[model samples]
Target chain A: MKTYKCYCIDLDGTVYRGKEPINETVQFVHHLQQQGKEPFFVTNNASQTPDQVLSKLSGFGIEAKRSHIMTSAMAAAKYIAYHYPGKDVSMIGERGLHDALLENGVNIVSSSKEVFVMGIDREITYEKLAQACLDIRQGATFISTNSDRAFPNERGLMPGNGAFTALIQNSTGIEPIFIGKPQGHMLEMIRLEHQYEKEDMVMIGDNYDTDIMAGINFGIDTIHVNTGVTSTEEALLKSVRPTGTFETLVECI
Target chain B: MKTYKCYCIDLDGTVYRGKEPINETVQFVHHLQQQGKEPFFVTNNASQTPDQVLSKLSGFGIEAKRSHIMTSAMAAAKYIAYHYPGKDVSMIGERGLHDALLENGVNIVSSSKEVFVMGIDREITYEKLAQACLDIRQGATFISTNSDRAFPNERGLMPGNGAFTALIQNSTGIEPIFIGKPQGHMLEMIRLEHQYEKEDMVMIGDNYDTDIMAGINFGIDTIHVNTGVTSTEEALLKSVRPTGTFETLVECI
Candidate 1:
């Protein structure tokens, strides 16, 4: 098997399932580290900062560097700073997104009709949502971190950022520029920042739609693991198959 | 011009414009009352109770009976109680919806998989929305008070119940049965409850889509007034024209 220099990995199912780590993937990551290769952790989660992700990974017995974590929030902030330079941004999101924009030196304004970034805000209110619509109606460009409709919790499937995005889109009749998986902005960020060629990079994940499709969209090799959202059977049904399939990361290692 | 026995009038754009009364509509309502006829005030507003709506009309110098005011929340509660008798319902809404369901004798449960009613919840939270999605995923039937994506407020157009409904619907992959305008449930409720025949009724409003379309869908005569959302010129352009078009209800009077 050919070895890739940069391994972009999905976190939720590939590294850990909520609080529990996937042993096979964790072992594979340790093996990669032993070989002096630091794999990048790519996640669509916009609520947690890289530091927070690093802490979570640490709890799961995985030693990951802060620079190796690429969240959708970071990508969104980078995209805004790159595309609309010096434009003040109004946002509706939580700490992770706030931190990302602040770190990226994007001017954060309370009210602006120029650029608006949306993320999952637990303390979401009708007033906040109204302000977003008001801004969008006033011709503000809309951007969202991820498009995961519903996320799993201790109780059950909960409303994700995508559901809120749908609300705003339905209200304003404007589709937002989604900066998450299946769009490949995150992968592009990793590639450009690290200067890794497409041939030397690979995306390894458990979900076919967001993870594998994201790799395919980025024109990179992808390995689908039957550990999370999309099982091997479901992944095979898709027309755009992954570069490889594994029962777990143990086979890849 | 023909006078109808049941004059169904829209509230926001027709009778009043955001706390200010449309003089022509108020005068027309007074004229109807002088002839011992109480015009029915129909609104897609699911946030206010019948008494609340009556008070608003009274503030406009028009005395309205509580029973004469038809709100979407009332219709939704009645619909749920009639269709799924004795079934417990989980809901995401405000005082108007709560009072209506209680008045209609529908059991409101916190975690029920029987029926789910959605309305404009100004104090909306992520947890509440998540719970609603969970209940719906557990096989609960979905119902929404109205499908108004956005409504005019002091700040401008604000996200309405329909927008929130869109959020839940997107998350759950379940379409809700909307009870408000353009669906004709509110009109049907007024007709069935008051025993008004099709010819005896004439729906009057300022908006062509919700108000005029409600009357059209309800199989009744409709008067399009240029006092609010849709202009007379815009109304004429629609493929399904209203029964009559006027600058104000003064023409009908």
Candidate 2:
């Protein structure tokens, strides 16, 4: 097995599955940490701030660095700051996205015809969506954190950020530039921030579509674990297979 | 112009646009009422009640009967009452849908696996959408009022019922049974209630996709008034053309 300098790990499915940590993944992450390597926690969950994510990880007995946590919100903020600098941005998101934008020095406005970013806003309203449509129609650059259609909760799989993004897209007939997994923006952000080559990075996750495709899209090696959304059998069936497919991260350890 | 006993007029584009009524449409409605024909005002707007719509019409100097007004909410209520009688139905809508379901004697429950109906809910919440997805995933029959992607408002083309429906559909991977224009449910309801044959009915509207398509789908005559969404030139390009296309309802008068 080959080792990478930067291991980009997905949070929800890879490290833990909604409050319960996968034992093998936890062990593998521990092994990496013991080797003086800090893996980046790359999550598409734009709802939570880095500190919140760190708290969740700490609950699972995994100590992660705040700077090593690259959320979709952070990536979107950085993407906007890098691409459209000095442009006023309008957003529809939660605390994570709002904080990330402020941290990245992106000017937040009530409404803008410059740029618009969206994430998982639990308190979503018709007025927010309406304003987004109006802005997009007025030639605002539309950007979304992720394209996850539905995500699992304690109750069931609920509508995620992508569904709301779909609403705005359907209403305005405009597609948004997604800055999450399967699009490679987050992975690219990690690479650029840490000054690591593509070969030095490897994405490890249990989801085939978001995690594996994200790595592949970013031209990095990907390892798919079968302890979550996609099984080994399903991952093998894809035309462009992952670099490695295992029953669990224990195999890598 | 071919005279019809039942003239099924669309509300938004045909009768009025936003707060203002089209003068020709007002005159046309007055003409029909003077001739002792109470034309049915068929609308995909599931937000307002029949009385509310009637009051708006009356404000434009056109007296319309309460029974002669058919909203998507009413049609959805009647559809549920007829097909799935006594079924506990769950909904995501406003006063119109709420009253319509209760008036039709359809049992309304907080959450149900029997039936789920959705309308244009401006006060849409993430929890409401989550509950709807959960109910639909639990094998509930999903139904939406209309499929109009965007509706005009004071601001601009805001996210309509169809956009929200698309959100639920995307999340649950379930197609909803649309009970609005372009599906013929409202027209079918009007036909069944008034005991008028399809031949005796004519759908008059400014939007070709919703109004004309509904009439054609219901196997009734359709008149296209170029005063709203679809222009007369664009209506002429469709493979299935309306029976008549005019600049305004004054041409028909």
Residue lDDT tens for model 2, A1-253:
8999999999888899898999999999999999999999999999899999999999999999999999999999999999999999999999999999999999999999999999999999888998999999999999999999999979989899999998888888999999999889998888888999999999998889999999999999999999889999999999999999988899998
TM-score of chain B of each: 0.98, 0.99
TM-score for each predicted model, relative to the true structure: 0.98, 0.98
Model 1, chain A: how large is the TM-score? Answer: 0.99
Question: On residues B158-181, what C-alpha lDDT tens digit does candidate 1 reach at each position?
Answer: 898989999999999999999999
The 0-to-1 C-alpha lDDT of every candidate, in the order given, reads: 0.92, 0.93
Question: The CA-based lDDT of model 1 is what?
Answer: 0.92
Candidate 2: TM-score, chain B only = 0.99
Which DockQ values do the candidates obtain, in the order shown?
0.87, 0.84
Q: What's the TM for model 1?
A: 0.98
lDDT of 1 by residue, A1-253 (tens): 5799999999998898877899999999998999999999999999999999999999988889888899999999999999999998999999999999999999999878999999999999888899999999999999999999988878888899999999999999899999999889999999999999999999999989899999999999999999999999999889989999999998877
